[model samples]
Target: MKVTQIPFQKIGFFSKTMLDYLEKNPKINPFYNNFPDFEGFQKQIAEKQTSFSKSSRLVLAEALKNQYESFEISEKTKTNISLLKKEHTFTISTGHQLNLFTGPLYFLYKIISAINLAEELSVKFPNQNFVPVYWMATEDHDFDEINYFNFDGKKVTWNRKDGGAVGRFSTDGLDAVFDVFSEHLGNSKNAQYLKKLFADGYLKHHNLADATRFIANELFAKYGLVIVDGDDAKLKELFIPFVRDELEHGTSFKAVSKTIERLANNYKIQVNPREINLFYLGDDYRERIIFENNLYKVNNTEIAFSKDEIFKELHKNPKAFSPNVIMRPLYQEVILPNLCYIGGGGEQAYWLELQDYFNAVNIPFPILLLRNSVQVISEKQARKLAALNISKEELFLNQHELITNKVVENTAIETNFKDKKQFLEQQFLDLKEVAKKTHISFLNAVNAQERKQIKGLEKLEKRLLKAEKKRQTHLVERITILQNELLPNQSLEERQRNFSEYYLEYGITFIDVLKIALKPLELQFTILEI
Candidate 1:
């Protein structure tokens, strides 16, 4: 959160098709359409009971304790329990890896978007209610990626020697990671606070689930955002039928593949699909899943859930099954009916691909909305442009073009030179007319003098231009430096590690100001400048 400067420029990451789709649908505000109200929003908007794929996909949920636990309940989860979730409660879901500490500003943005959107939904429909949900990416095996977060140019990494589904990893190893991160903070004011938060959550906690919870709760506790880890066995029980169908008939993979093909035809954009169903709780686990599959396996740890199950069992003894992406979404839908999902561009893209899979499984695919992203510019950066007598928009322009335009704007040229030259030509013409009347004697002399004057003016103009160029050499260097900073190999704003640089100039309320300025999301073509 250290202060720095935010360089402003347009981030044109979307394709022409995306822009066109957005532009053409001017009246259709996706988020508002889907999640305008909390009361019956899930049932009405999401169509949770509806099948996702033509093949009939169902929603699934796994419990808290293990990859697949038969019976276990943590006291903490029990204390935070809700009644067998009766009708229509508002829900906001944001996903994050089980980062030992909250991963990055991106993580903050995800949960923040959920909270903000939930608030917006509540206001729009004052009669209803809303709540926040954080979905933990606990079953994810990609430990290397979520193991670190970037701070400024430095990387803060947690080097846990063991790796599987990170949820299963013990939280004891996070202290070393914290120590390394603390050293990198190097005496910043907020560094100590961040370190304290990490220690209290990760080091003092019992597991990765607690670690994720503590960090997320710290940021979103005020907003009443509750976090859920779907790695529980009882939760996976709900997913049993879907797991059985996927294993027996191989429906998920087949259904998703067809959907992707059809989507590509519709949108003219290709999506990658695996021939084999990506739902791999394993064939072994699938048999033990009690899914009505033909195969028989032991009361194995992965799946042993029948269709007739209780919500309390999933909530209490959740350490039973492993929930993958396909199953996880189902779990969310089953646990709490949700109307829509507000997420980033990449997240939206992935969701589009999942729609077919949802349809096949008989679970409704929630409406997806792309969230707002921004680049913040500081007062000092604005002043730098003002001092240079150039607009920051010009800073965003190509460096060479900016310089050329600056040269033309600032160069001093004598307007009288053109008039003087014309006068000399007129004088020569008059002299020639006189010569013709009297004699051809001084005509040559007049022409010679006129030529000399023209040459002198041309030289004078060049000298003046040269002087202006000399005067502006340092300014040109600054522009070059600006280009180097702004137009590097990667995008400046997209890759920025900290939001403080923007906040330093725009104040802590910048996000609020942006929300007001940007709320009626129909306005397009932003050229944010310093």
Candidate 2:
């Protein structure tokens, strides 16, 4: 396996907010507490060490132990969980929805980034321990988003009627999905392993949360990856004080609104804050908590509570209160002794808006790191790309742009009329001088003629380029076919395809290559040729 790194900006897929943050743009600096570097981490460790309490660490460790009691865990994972009780141990966390079979290929990239960062941090700060965490978004209620995954260009879906929190969803109907997915895999050793992995993960577990935890642990537990389910009552209890603050003062909405007002002038706003960022999570429903008519009411539901009643309910049943996108980051930071957060560009964009909110609640904001992105190319595909003489960076260009540039480069034609255009402009300049010497009205006619000639040259240049493309039809076809194969549906492979597509062929070696290749702190797009 060979690995190469490119800047995120070169890919043209990441947002300006993320690129700016990666570049340490001053305008984007205030939105985060520390940059993700060794120096920044040293400062972050100091901040978190002072802010995170010993009692909170004990609670976090005990909660993780209870959550993992039912499953057989690797010794590395067990050791990491126990080490969380120590004052010097901090977590490097990445969160994702429990997508079926781990949704897209980047799922592996996200967790691998966390694991690699932990190892690097451990080497950097030998006295301190860094545990990698995968925080499961079990409280998320969007079932449609996590119900299906693409396999061999087909979407294997789990059809069910689920509401409330998705983590609590029963895994009764997943056997159908497993059967369909199994049909796609042949009886090779790798294929059988995948089949059993899916069957045991989904068909055997009772709920989506447990199934997801089992699968993630099976994949990365050997690396000491600790998976945390945020939907647990014990975890929710730790967040009760923040939930109460959000309910009474609407602190998140107020603080994030102020940040967005200034943020919108420069970058795109990711998520808008509601008047209240807490949700009322029932057994069958998860609704937003809204304040109206001197009462706190759950939207689309008849449940209503006065200020005192809401606080009473919160203290009594903290599990019923869920944080929305605006407040979820605060809850994660409040519970974990985390130094950095690894996520995709979109995740990092929303996180950039919450620094002031974290400050308002007196919670330390962790350093936001853009997760490692990768494009895995097979040896055959890499050879095709080489034969076509297209650089890996060029593969990221728009199809039309890539075609135009490559066609112009390969054709024996002067498609770009740079010299001709410059010469025409000079001729026009000479004409204007003559017109100036003769009469002012003549200069307008001269200017009109110049514009006409320039337009004609541009038109001819485009026509020549089109002719060259027709002549080199073979080149265009090869470029399109290779690009389509690598970038399925004209989108990043990580977003469109599942990791099972690669695992079937390379087996565990595929994951091992990724674990070794992905470097979170480098913050670059990787092109791994296997």
Candidate 3:
């Protein structure tokens, strides 16, 4: 949201294009207002439960225990937990789909947004509690996406035979990752901090769930943001009833299905329909047998669940079930005692597709907020704009369109017989009106004569404009070269290329300087060349 203005030179030229474009196009995206509406929805949610709800408390307790167990809660998580206990008026909650080594810097932006928002709300709400909660994407099924970080010129990736959930992937599998990271850190003064971060989190942890928890805990633990993994025995117990209902009535698909269909009517994006026959899983306690069409188990254990019995047990203990697609929001509602969930653009889209399911389950849908995204510019990019006589604002325009504006503005058409053509067209219009009284047929002849005259003038204008363009061909060529160098790739700063480009000038404080003026939620990446 904060940056320099477009250069003064290009602004004057773009102003004319702006005026022309405004004449032709209505200035709004047609899809802008079709957002998921909350009419009568908030009341339904508030009525469902508060943080004080039994299910909500259970979720928090389970998440805390899981995070503690996962990381061995060095003094770090303990300190963070203590801060939360002391300042429990409000908390920010941010969630991510487990990306390999935390996908992009946007992941960082999501958490930072949650944290900053919680801080803002604390000032406004004064007496209420706020805590920033990180929902560890422990259940995400994709492994290929969540396994690497691009550093320097090399991709530091996990070499593993991945299957099932990333949460349960063992930490010991990340040794090769640490080796690469250590090599990169190589004798730097801050190597120790980076090394410990990798060690206690990656090398020593057991899964993506644990490693992410450790890293988050180390950074914001002191600030009281709690990281939680949802996949745990105790946590599953909280949503046991919902889980059972999904299996019994085949409700998840049926319930969430209705929402998706309803959403398809309004939102442009359509979500995949939820499945009705859900997968059944429980600890095997008998002979090994694969149980779907048949039965299966290992180590003297057999699958002990039947669809009906699971439901019966869940009905007996609502606190014991975990909800699938139809039930997750119900479970999250029951457990988190949260007021809102801050999500990324795609995440918000999917969440919008599921509101009807929340309605079906008698759960209130949480507030869905989109995280902000941004581009960073350096001193060089800023100066380049000025030198080109292009305003900083022009950077936001499509590159080709901006080029066309520059070309048209600088081109000088020869005004050969300009007034004569305009004067003749005006005379014809005057004659057509006067001729109407003498004979209605004569009026038509006069109108045709005016049209021919206008066409001739338009043709002459085109030729003049073409010659003017030819005369300024060198300038047009220069602008095209600059446009290609500046754009072509959409990024404001080429991140994968280098940070040393800025860091050499800023030194170790480059990160601190960036974190100062910008909110973490505003921009996903930044390239600050001092």
Candidate 4:
């Protein structure tokens, strides 16, 4: 396996907010606590160590112990869980929705980025331990987003009627999904392993939370990856104070809204804060909690509470309240003694809007790290790309643009009209000088002629390029076929393909290569040639 790194800016997919955050632009610095570098981490460790209480660590460790009591885990994971009680052990966490069979290929990339960062941090700060964490987005209620995964160009989905928290969903209809997925996997050793993995993970587990936990643990437990499910009563109890504040003061709304105003001056706002950023999560429903008419009411339901009554309910049933997108990051930071958060660009964009909110709640904002993104190409594809004189970076260009550039480069025709355009501009400049010597009105006619001539040159350039493309049709065909193979659906492979597609061929070594290749702090797009 060979690995190459390119700047995220070269990838042409990230947002300006994310790219600026990665570059540590001063405008973005105010929205986040620390940059995600070694210097930033050293300061972060000091801040977290001073601010995070020891009692909270004990509660976190005990809650994790109770959560993992029934499952079998690796000794490394067990030790990491135990180590959480120590003040020196901090977590490097990444959260994702409980996507079926780990949704897209970047699922592995996110976790692997966390694991590799933890390993790197362990080496950098030997006295302190860094544990990798996969915080399961179990409380998320969006079932449609997590119900299907694309495998070998086909979507293997678990169709079900689910509401409330998706983690609490029943894994009833997944057997049919497994059967369909199994048909795609032949009877090779790797295929058999995947079949059993699916059967054991979803078939045996009762709820989506347990199944997701089992699968994530099975995949990363050896690397001491600790998976946390935040839907537990014990965990919710820790967040009760924040929930109460949201109910009474609407603290998140006040803080995040103000931050969004400032962020919007230079960046696009990611999520708008509601008057109340908490959701009422019941057995069958999860809806926003809105304040109106001197009462706190759950949207889409008849359940309503007065100020005092809502406080009583919060104290009695803390688990019934859930954090929305605006508050989930604060909740994750509050619960974990974390140093950094690894996620995709969208996740980072929202997290960037929450620094003031974290400050308002007196919770330390953890460093935000953009998770590693990868394009896995086979050796055959790599050779094809080289033979076509296409750099890996060029593959990120729009398909039409890529084809045009390749045709212009390989064709014997004068497709590029750059020299002609420059000469025409000079001639227009000379004509304008003559027009200035003659009359002012003549200059307007000269300017119009210049614009028309430039337009004509551009049109002719396109025509010549289109003609050359037809002449070199075979080259265009090869480039199109190879690029499509590498970047499926004209999108990043990590966004469109599932890990199972590669696992079927390379087995567990696929993940092993990712762990070795992904550098979380480098903050670059990785191209892996296998």
Best by TM-score: 2
Overall lDDT per candidate, in order of appearance: 0.54, 0.93, 0.54, 0.92
Global Cα lDDT for candidate 1: 0.54
Residue 62 of model 4, lDDT score: 92
Evaluation by TM-score, superior candidate among 2 and 4: 2
Model 1 lDDT per residue over 292-411, tens place: 343322234544333334223334444444445545555566555566665555555545566656666666667554444443444555566677777644655656567767776766
Give the poorly placed runs of model 2, Cα more than 4 Å off.
437-442
Comparing 1 with 4 on TM-score, the higher-scoring candidate is 4
The Cα error of candidate 1 at residue 252, in Å, is 1.9
Those runs of model 1 whose alpha carbons end farther than 4 Å from true positions after fitting are 1-10, 15-21, 24-84, 186-189, 266-271, 275-327, 385-489, 492-530
What's the CA error at residue 344 for candidate 3, in Å?
1.7
lDDT of 4 at 496: 94
Query: Residue 242 of candidate 4: its Cα lDDT?
Result: 90
* Top model number, lDDT: 2
What order do candidates take by TM-score, descending?
2, 4, 3, 1
Question: Residue 462 deviation, candidate 1, in Å?
Answer: 21
